[model samples]
Target chain A: MSPRQKRQLSLEVNGEPYELLVEPHWLLVDVLRDQLHLTGTKIGCGIGVCGACTVLVDGQAVSSCLALAVDAHGKAVTTIEGLAREGRLHPIQQAFIACGGFQCGFCTPGMIMGAKELLDRNPAPTEEEIRAGLSGNLCRCTGYVKIIESVQVAVRLLQEEMAGEAGAPVSPGPGRHAAVGSGQGGAR
Target chain B: MALWPFDYLEPTSPEECFALMAEHGSEAKLLAGGTALMQFLKQGLARPRALINLKRLPGLGGIEVGPEGALRLGALATHRRIEDAPLVRERWPMLAEMLQLVASPRIRNMATIGGNLCHGDANEDPPPLLLALDASVRVISRVGERLLPVDGLFTDFYETALKPGELLAEVRVPPLPPRSGAVYLKFAPKSRQDFATVGAAAFVRLADAGRCVELRLGLAGVAPTPVRARKVEAALQGQLLSEPLVREAAALVEDEIDPVGDIRGSAGYKREMAKLFLRRAVAEALRRAGAAGPGPT
Candidate 1:
């Protein structure tokens, strides 16, 4: 039996569907970390200012701490844990490690998620654009130099991955690598 | 950091939402994009009994231009959506550019422009710009709908002119004035996402050999509500514009604002910044207006 004032939440997280009976006030971060055991999403500052609890809801990066569990209903949610597929790390995650994006690692997940959103929209973002895209997420360590570098590395990695795969829908079209970090890619 | 338990209700239609608003009265909070409200809830600042989610309602998420060329932003349209709308970029490029810097990309992806105005913070960027643009919000209730000018929307700190049951349904921005140039200046000493230490927006329309046909100014971070810098505007209107002339008029901005000392800056510093920024905003606006020499009809 559902507890009093608890609502059932149905959402897809990390390619897995979850049906949760959550208190109406329960935040999406709490549910993902507690009930669903997806603790990769961290909570740095409880307020929305910190992107520590960032998650992609419907492919848009949003603060999970600020989102009600019920708001995730019928939406596809992606957390930090979702970046790896079939034991292969996503390009962003790989770039973060390769470039030393984080020292404490608390902000890495949110940073990667924010970068994912940025690269998805604009595969090759300028340094300024990359900074603007992930401005919402903050890192108290390393002064953001390596963090920015990580995103740039991710951009090159993603371009190489897409270029290697032919017939992939939405590949940044021909001569995309020429533009590099200065302009738009091929498709989307 | 726990939020108070509440009923989360999604109404499929405006009528149902209105009824829920009426039934719950003060206890029901409308959720558009809950960027600010969620902050309030998690902080124990708000304890509403129910949250009426407005996402299911149709026609409230579109950004369209009417035959008159006015831009209509649906209440549920997120800031990111409005910023990305090709029509907004084509018509109101300055506004599109401004939206790119509101909070951050993630926050913009979730915060509705309607909700941003409704949150009624005096230090926000959009209010001053909206005031300069002569925007109006359409408030809908079960009884009827009415348009309220942006100037008259914010009544007090952390408050708006909206009544308990009235929902702000849309923001209507008139087409950019003919041959007009606009600029929004913000003084955020801290991060780019922080509230403006002081901000100003101006619109200048040049007519007949660079004489100022019309000039308007709006300011924030210096008052309980976004202000129309009338004294400054009055000083410059119909005058042949010059740097000294603009500077002299902008000095009157000190009288237009009542800034409170906060983390942003002291009241005295804000007043001086207000004058400085107002002068810069007007000058930049004039430069832009002059560049559009032939003037668009």
Candidate 2:
């Protein structure tokens, strides 16, 4: 009978603290895209069936469309826009580009976010684990072969970075060398 | 599309939650993981005047083993937690395996077990397995707390037996009986994320002579609510384990189910698959029990 009231939400996004008044019914994806202007998080099949709205809430991949902005009041939220740091892309992002993981780019952000969470938990996941981790994300293009390869390449790049072999900014150019990409030629 | 506007209430304790529920009653919807409720809200299926957020409720989220070796799963435990929990995996691997097959990694991370149960969706994977395992849920309100068997939790389509002001706090799963085994088999012809056309779970305890000492069967997606196939169980219980006996008992599942036609399958198709899965689940459970060694008494 009464009008819905906005609630105060205080949370951290991309390492920045924010305090805003949001409607109680506003989904986290809307708040991220509209309120914060972080449109990198895409919303597909808003009913949580599609993983196009994946984001990290407290380092765990969750469907932002299913989470109310109020539910994220005290948590650290990471959108796909936050994956890069200091003008350099995250390894997963670089891997997605190098491995041709995206064709339409509609599902790329969510796929990369999901892959980030997967690698964060299990740095060196097997192929089956990679597929299982990205099972929630559906890519209408690329047929998932390159997406799986991208995650595998990301793992090797991360392992190389950890070993201090290639600390330089990973070039997004073609023919960039990946340890795992060596033996599998023309697969990209 | 935006969700319909609603006021929000965040209650930090069970007493506060119960008070809010008592005041708001049917006008309020309690939110745990928000995976199921959020979809309902977005689709205009539910228009609660107030959304009660239960994230801050203390002692409502955790997995612990009770003194008697029973597993106590807090209502707020996510499917991801259940799938990865060492205690659940070691004690009730069937439950963990079932949880692993739910939706996907993201949905599993966001969907809570309590919310899943309270949603009372027959297409879900956990209810039938929980029913077959003889699990019970603890429902608490300001007045008192009571235990309801998981089999009795679902009353109808998208309806639960939880009364107004009553909240499901935790699920208590009894430890598997000695020489007993359980299996949950889901038949999803579509993608892995799709709901099962006919999901079946079976628990069997074998006697030393390979006779079935006990058998419990539960099915989902073939009825308005998850149901225990009592007729099938009765046919198999205390009988000598055999291929023909299992097949005959499983065939009784067709008569026990009341399926509805949907995109997954026709009612008749689901009924047939229910019988097929029931047979496989019972046979696998019997084989596993035999491998577990001598039965208790």
Candidate 3:
């Protein structure tokens, strides 16, 4: 039996209001995946060594595994599931799918979430910033080449969208043959 | 991983935090950003009875520019806030560079500058640079407030001057003198998350004719705590800015520091690396002062 008190936790995750009875000690990652069934927020190395549990808390990326659920009260949380809208994927999400950003996919949610944060803060981050932005996250399967390509594509897509390039269809390129939902290793 | 069970208090005012500290003193841990503190709890290194959340406190997160171009950085200022500040980038580019190299974006977002300074981990990079800048810390408690020189903040290995009931309030950094430049350089093997094996920060002020007027040298991962190479500082105080002077000052650093061997690197390797970093950092700082200010690139 877990000796923890239940608290009324009110949070806005993915632009939706959620009021759940959460244990005071429960991590935000647990609340998102276990209670809310938002499995897109995966947990890896619960001690914060791995950035697989990254999520946007109030538009800033934080390691949800280390963040207590109670601390997220009155805050906004965004997970991988929140990246798409109206049957259309967010440009970054689409770019990741197109650009072979993930190989094993265990680290995809975190990679995308971390990328989302960088683009939000600095729309046109340099190559060094992208390397530094995703430094906390470790992807053993795909060398960072395709991941870097994915971010570059997203930058162009998001930039076009910002400049009123609405409904621009993502074209095929080096990212065209990326496997979707297969979770296999990308090109060596 | 769930946090260990503990009572929580979110105090919006300093008085409430003080009162809680007085009541729970050693039993409670004040949490700011919860980056390092939460990691401690999760690892079972600490099991405080209560957690006093400092996030709700007002007036603890602002960065104010004082008269004489001093910077008064609040304890709760996040690394992101400090790294991107126009004043910090313009006046203290070393701080900006160090912040950019610290951890990563996700960690930097939730980690506080005060928390990083307070942690005092040898492998960490900020404390040494701050000490080189001659910064002072403002600590508050139920009793009153006290200002401690950054050099005096760290006592022994992994220990600081902070008492049980007191909290670090702010860090006051005086403006750098003209003709002076500072640089922080660290060597981390493998990826960026790895702790540094050797780190050096140098602040050098040159004379009108390009001679060294003043010098402050700080080294990390080369001592139990981040420390100033006082012997090296004394050697280069009045010397001309040259390769020979830099080599002399760098040679003195190896004698002043006593680093212990660990998985990061051998003690001898650390010493040699320290010398290399010191020489490079001093040369770069002097060159910056000689040029027409450090231009943006």
Candidate 4:
């Protein structure tokens, strides 16, 4: 009769690699929050229904609460804690602040992470697309209007950031209006 | 949702998986995506001694379509992959649309089609549509491999026909026939992500003069297992369908489903909904086939 044993998990989280021993039953959230002490990834519903524990695994959003930590071995994971660069807040975080997108701050990190994934995929998504993209992540504050407005502002900010990055007129995606009106109302 | 301590086993090959399955027997559960099984673990509904993860199993995560338009979805192909596949969107639009209606995007990214089926939840969205599309699953074990029609896969609540030491390898979906149209409708009024109050799927093929050449109806959330309404299909086969006639055939579902409703609705409400949705799904399928007018004759 064999006893349950811990397994070694090696994963790159937010550009940092770590090697740790994790229990077989332990979830990715457990490894991230408890082991690594990265408490930004919240566990809301425990089940996958709430978007509280959402994280990016290999660039695709998935529920950390439902994923096994060992299964994340050899993969790249991005939590809400990983978004900043050079001690400056990511544009999504800035947009959330600029637009007052959050209330009580419990769902903010997850919302920002979800938005980062969404904007990374489609730089300029429609309001409906933004709503559907973040469907899994719920805001209990019922601040959906400002949350959507925050995403819209992020679209413009990201477009401006990309336009600045590219140093010329750039087409973000298939969305025409988000691109053609580049100069007007970008920061707001 | 504190999971019990268990040994984690990652098998790189099917033979190794089968061997482990044989050794662990029912005490071990095969891990595919772990979206549902994790719930089973956290809720203490399943106290497995080990979890044999299928993530490392090679050649099982592919999504390939044959030249004949048949889709061979490897067991590990995530719902996100299937939903975003270009060929699937072009050929099997009904399936693509249905995948979008599944839980949220995060769940879809983590949930695999094989895992969803093997989870054997009667209220899930995929089984009804897969049943209507005439999908079959390739189940493998140490002895050999065999294909089981999707209908024969589910045995009961959270149970499947897969024997011990066997695992689902792939899901094979045959191409839709010419002049055929398919649809899946989930009646979840509360939230788009909620399990269906009742789910219905229909595949219809038309011959000349709009006569029904073939019809298949599948329903979920109203039975012990996802069920095909063969009696209804039999009644509509080779007949020129009218709204009244289709409604008459759909009414047969009232007796076919055995729903034990909880918060969704009463069992009687679900049975009634099953009949109504069966009729609507068939009508929509017919219209999509261009076999009938916008309003059914």
Candidate 5:
């Protein structure tokens, strides 16, 4: 087959702007991992079925494996590496770590990214909604029991944090797990 | 494996899209949302010389009410949007419900209704419901435009009636008449995200005193294309809504469907479930219609 022409793509990943030339066949996951060296995003199935390569395109979760890099032009792309704040882990990430959401850790990044989208949209999603939200992300390790709990914990952490920032009273609700601190080093 | 290399074209308008299609002819494929097209590209099932991404095209990504009070869904509207659209949820709950049941939430976020129909995948959930609702698609080319019923849209597996350069612009679903109800039911033996073993959609219009005025039933995953169970409809229409009548009518679906054995189920099992689901869908539709209040005088 003849060589494919490369297209220049300009995208906002996390808060950083990236301008790169990529082949039309280069998937977003490849560009993120191979070219940019942001390897937090994992690829399980090259097809869209597996959510291991889930990323946020303009705040909506999408499978990077199925998306061409050229399609990310002028769009804000958020991978697993972008989830944390200046130095603190995102509440979803903290919740996963605290709740034992992963075993092999292969699907953690994608699961956390999917959870981020879920919490961003529905701060306090029901268990059924959480399952529906994370249905795309397969967890061969945890059997998804702890992953579901992690989302619930994340919801409480986020709600408490939001309430704290607003100077509102934080009454401890029943069955609310204590907030987990970010023990890991500053965001990668 | 990496996708086969291909040139990507971003068209800002329908005319430009048509121009690209005209130039590339059968060598180009339109990309909307890329949920289906991307899979085909990566699996080497489709290696188009050019991919025309429709995201840049304006005026093709909204849900609105047309002049006749019909729901007009722009071709590029995502499945998630349809599932969450307030107008869709309130007016056509069945459509919204079915949309929610299509793949996972993330896939729904990226899959477009237009691409779903054009892909012509027989196992999808939307086509059967659309067919039962008498939905039609608006297709346009450089030459002219035409409206084709959803029933005739799918010619065969992965094949649509759209000719070269013809693009599906919008899907129009007529507003349900008074005392009418529609329901979509799918039997997935595997995970919830898996495609249905036998999917059934039924729309029933009831007159005064609970008499069936009109009925339509559409089945999926049991045929080469989404099929309307005309025999079932004929049996149920004009009959008094009753349990026995619905059961008898739904049994006709077994004869109308041509199911293929697959991992989901054997052909015989699917055919049996098709009849059962059809019965349940028709009965549920009647119940919903009765609860919807009395028909027009």
Candidate 6:
């Protein structure tokens, strides 16, 4: 074992910038928990296998435990705590709560972050796509029934909000445009 | 709970990283995405005195097509980038699909292509696909640079041809000919957080006359390393992609692989699954080829 070395790093979390002295040995998950005191991101495997430590790095879900705090310099990160804005939960969080997407809640943060990416790129996704999107995350409590239902609920809520704002859109529903425009959509 | 202490050097230049590698030799390791390396460190499988972080190194992350139609996959290009790249999706959608099958969404966002290849896990889905695509891995050292075929890149399970002081630059996959289709299939138990029991990738080329002109079959997780099934290819060469021929080719994987029993599967079961995956992968590739504007005959 060797003494930990400190490094100067800057990171943006939940739309707020923080500059801190982090050890080279410090994992992003640890920094978020111990230093920043945002303990929403839980640690399960410590390795990348379990998605329990998932967080959004630049709007993409990543395992915080595998990420070095130094590697996150000059990047945008969002922990589970960042999802609620001004005491109002993000749509996904609300959907999770409404749909009962968690059981023991140990895997809820990672699952929410994973589904958040899917909804960001695709507000409406098929069950297969939803399964693929959340495949990395493992949940022993709910058997993924409520989790899938949670994403569906989020999609419906987002579509209803969009349709209400757009003032009655086409037959495909709001934000339901085919991925044919960008060719990013896969499967039905 | 956290990474062990080591001198971290985020070299802004590849030359600087390479020079540091040459100086530290085996005492150093390149940090791509840290998905695999970090796991290895936590498992006590790897520890080094220096980590040559490659993210800061210039020209290390990006995917582009070369003038010659080869797909240029940078070492630092994350799987998420590859999965989302329009170029990769347009030309080689199978690669994108393979990327999607690797780990979970969180892992894909941070796992680099170089890190996946260098991780040297026989169960990884990318190597078999890269091997089927006839991809080449570019390795850079302070001494010089060299490119090796994907099949030749792996020396053993958790071992690669990468020298101690060398860094993988990129994975270059040659363009497939027209009227070609490739598919990678893995038999991971539940399709979530499971290592592949048997993974097979098939790249098939149909002739203008409607016969099988060329075939490249690659398999992973059943052996010490991912292997190209030249035996199966030889059996199918010039043969009509008849159901009979495909069955014969599928049976050949059982003969060629030297599988090891593991928790995921017994050696016998892996051989069985390899045969199964080979058949499905070939049929899927052929079906895709046929669907691509009625290939040949």
Predict model 6's lDDT versus the native: 0.84
TM-scores of all predicted structures = 0.93, 0.95, 0.92, 0.94, 0.94, 0.91
**Ranking of all candidate structures by their TM-score, best first:** 2, 5, 4, 1, 3, 6
Question: Which candidate do you rate higher for DockQ, 4 or 5?
Answer: 4
Off by over 4 Å in 1: A1-4, A167-188, B291-297
Q: For candidate 1, what is the DockQ-based docking class? A: medium
Displacement of residue B226 (Cα, Å) in model 6 is 0.7
User: Across residues B1-297, which tens digit of lDDT does each residue of candidate 3 receive?
Assistant: 566688888888888889888898788887887888888898898899888888898888878787757898999999989998998888787888998878777888888988887887777888878878888999998889999998998988778999887899899888988888888887888669767888888888887877688888888899988999888889888877557766876798877889998888889999999998888777777776663322221
Backbone clashes, candidate 5: 0
Cα distance off (Å), candidate 4, residue B155: 1.5
Candidate 3 segments whose C-alpha is farther than 4 A from its true place: A1-4, A164-188, B291-297
* Candidate 1 per-residue C-alpha lDDT over B1-297 given as tens digits, one digit per residue, 9 for 90 to 100: 678778888899889988898899998888888989998887778888888998888888889997778899998899999999999999898788778868888889889989999999888888888988888999999889999998899899888999877999999998876668887888888887778999889888888677888778999899998889999999989988677777788888888799999998999999999998888787777767664232111
Worst 10 residues of 5 chain A by lDDT: A179-188
Whole-model lDDT values for every prediction: 0.85, 0.88, 0.83, 0.86, 0.87, 0.84
Query: TM-score for chain A of every candidate model?
Result: 0.86, 0.89, 0.85, 0.87, 0.89, 0.85
- Which residue pairs in model 5 clash with each other? none
**TM-score attained by model 4:** 0.94
- In the range B48-149, model 5's lDDT, one tens digit per residue, is 998899999999988999989999999999999988999999998899999988887779989999999999999999999999999999999999999999
For residues B224-277, could you state the per-residue lDDT of candidate 4 as single tens digits?
888898888899999888888888888887767799978998999998899888
Docking class of 5: medium
Lowest summed lDDT across 10 adjacent residues in model 5 chain B is found at B288-297
Higher-scoring candidate on DockQ, 2 or 5? 2
Judged by DockQ cut-offs, the docking class of candidate 4 is: medium
lDDT of 6 by residue, A1-188 (tens): 65766888998999999999987768999999999999889999888777899999888889998999998999999988998767867767867776678989999999999888889988889999999898888899999988888788778766765776688554543233331221122111
- TM-score, candidate number 6: 0.91
Summed backbone clashes in each candidate are 2, 0, 0, 0, 0, 1
Model 1 chain B is weakest, by summed lDDT over 10 consecutive residues, at B288-297
